[model samples]
Target chain A: MPACPKCQGLIQETDAFCGHCGNPLAATDPDRREDVFDVLTPTLAYYFITLLLLGIYKLTSVFPEGFEGIIVITAIDVAIVIAFWGNYFQSLRPLFSLRGLSLKVMAFTIVGAMVGSVVVSVVAKWINLSIQDDVFYSTYMFQDTAYPFLFSTLFIAVQPAIFEEVAFRGFLFDNLLKVTPGKSTVYVTGFVFAIIHLNIISLLWLVPLGLALGFLRGRYNTLWYGMVAHFTYNFSLTVFEFLSWF
Target chain B: METSSVDSSAETLACENCQAVNSATQKFCSQCSFPIGGTKNEQIAFRSNIAVRTRMLKESERHVSICKKLLYFLAGINLLLGLYFGFAADDFPSMISSICVALLFLILTAWADRNPFGAILTAFIVYLTLNVVNIIDNPALLSRGIPSKIICTVLFVGGIRSARQVTLQREALEKLKAPGIGNR
Candidate 1:
């Protein structure tokens, strides 16, 4: 015999409810409880931290240059990913399992990324022709230096591919599926992903990209395929820019 | 102590815990001090009655109150916007629509406590219709329209959850009232 957790009344192992207090014993069941860093918690934490960092960026003006600001923000995002998922490494292991990471899905994601990139570029061009502003191009264009191509590949392509996938697909996507039912989880996650970018002009492209990534993550149940797709999209942009295709 | 009985031929009730025979009118057993004559079904029914009362109280105090507050808040915002557009901006069509929608939301809020499902359904229909008309009139409202659509989706989902809960509560109450059910 053991004491009930709520009222400390004597209870038998077979009992489903406390005899003395009549409290349901199901609340004490381990399977019913969720971890502190569930999907919603991390998603919310990411936004709260990002907003706080944005406020700091505005107030302090510590990183005056745009590139430096991006780097600092990316660093903060990485820190958030680590802080939230660090303790629950065991639970996250199943999300990255080898059985779920199929080569077919990987190839599909790569093709999807290529098609998505082309579509985005065409849309961006059309919008640019109408507006004649080239907001994205002017914002992301790096100075033509000796190592400009390498710099773009490292920071713009690889860094975001790894870090963003880890945060969105690996951490947030996996946890969201646990809480939400059906394909809506993917859409909701994508919505949050796009909103965090905080750029109205980019939303036109980012939202679709996010949805595609979310779909892949849910379909394959692994983050690696998403990383490949994201990397290819970013790297292709860098290559296209180097070739003066845009 | 003297061994006395109300009557030798009178009915005797047994205690559930100790099985001690006692008078039918006695509430507790003399031997075990446990409540007599109350069967397990009666206890279950008693507990369910308490649960139903508590759930009803909670639904009214928390869920319904929250829905009413949110409706009123949205109504207040719309009213302020209507006044601004009517007086300051001088946009008559927009102002009139805003005022009408505001009044509708306020009425829905007042009705929510009595008829939650109706209020929620009406509010959703009115809001969606208004937004659809406004969007048709001005396509440029698309940028601002997405956020409102998202909010309405959330409200719709909340309404669905509330409806499910109310349905479950109503079913439980009906079961409690059924003859020969949970009667021991």
Candidate 2:
């Protein structure tokens, strides 16, 4: 039976479209879109409590000065990654039973990252004239940094590719498909993905990325495809940053 | 269209308003939005979806709450450790760094409460800003680039995971309260 992408409502197998929501029922693979509220709330709550405590400490003269900010940021990043590792592996268990699919999905994620990054960079330059940022095409952040090559590669190439795909493609995309009424689910999820970046300049870059990723996931019916594409896009950025071409 | 009357017994099942023939097992009028007599099949289907979605959300929420508490505790410990190291080793930067680290984490947790995605983005921005500041200001830390890189890598990996976990739990919870599942 064909299913509605939005609400996961089943339709007749031979139906041209979903009767419940009127979405075209040509495809068999279901879309999965993650919910932002589900992903952000508890962490935000804890972060808030911690911030309050830090505020008091600063007021009382216990606040660390100079390089201490780096330490705190580093630790928070560590905590978040640990959580990602746990979830990523847990989610992967089911796919372990299907080794080929798993490999394909992983490859797909990397490719997606590369493509996304190239697209972002190109669009960034094209619209550079449209935005007003003294730091728009700076060689400073990438050039002056002692290990621009390493950090950019690691941050851009490795981390974002994996986590973003897991969050957006693996989880958000799937859940979104279950809630929406029709094909509107795809657009809604894509829009949410774009907005998540929280940068007006990034809106243009992200929306297309969202649509492309959504389409790839739906086309392949595998999370790995999105992941590979995401990875590729990011890896390319890392390389570009390394070469200082940007 | 003609107002045609159906043989009630022959059709066996029919809509009250539209009088359209339906199956004995069908629970809804295809033409008009009406209850198909007294069968509870649709009700059971509706309830099951709600129950499943609800259960998933609640389960994820509990996990998220625990993770949040854990992060807070970790921040506290890091802060205390910084104080101890500051006095013992007389390395003010190390001490400050530890305390600042705790503070940043706290900020992230707080920001996350209001906006989860914002918390992650801010965390990244904060980290990058702090590192850049340190690289410019602290010659000693700058000279120790390898160690800094290692530290960055470790934290980056860990942060991404924790961020993912927080988000996963949130997503599950949202699904629980989503529309359509519980709607009549």
Highest lDDT model number: 1
Alpha-carbon local distance difference test for all models: 0.60, 0.50
Question: What TM-score, to 2 decimal places, does chain A of model 1 have?
Answer: 0.74
Tens digit of lDDT per residue, candidate 1, span A1-246?
A: 577687786554544444445445543331233442333455555655654554455435555556556666667767876787785677777766677466776787788888877777678777664211322222243554456777678777787788778777776666656544437557656755664553445557786888888888887677778889989988776676666564
CA deviation > 4 Å runs, candidate 1: A1-39, A54-61, A129-141, B1-184
The whole-model C-alpha lDDT of candidate 1 against the native structure comes to 0.60
Candidate 1 recovers a fraction of native contacts equal to: 0.00
DockQ of each: 0.06, 0.03
User: Which candidate wins on TM-score?
Assistant: 1
Please identify model 2 stretches exceeding 4 Å from their true place: A1-78, A81-119, A129-148, B1-15, B22-184
Model 1: how far is B160 from its true place, Å?
13
Q: Give candidates' CA RMSD values in order.
A: 12.3, 15.7
A36-146 per-residue lDDT for model 2 (tens digits): 446444433433333333333333334453234323533454465456446556654442233446665566566656666666666677866322131112222344467
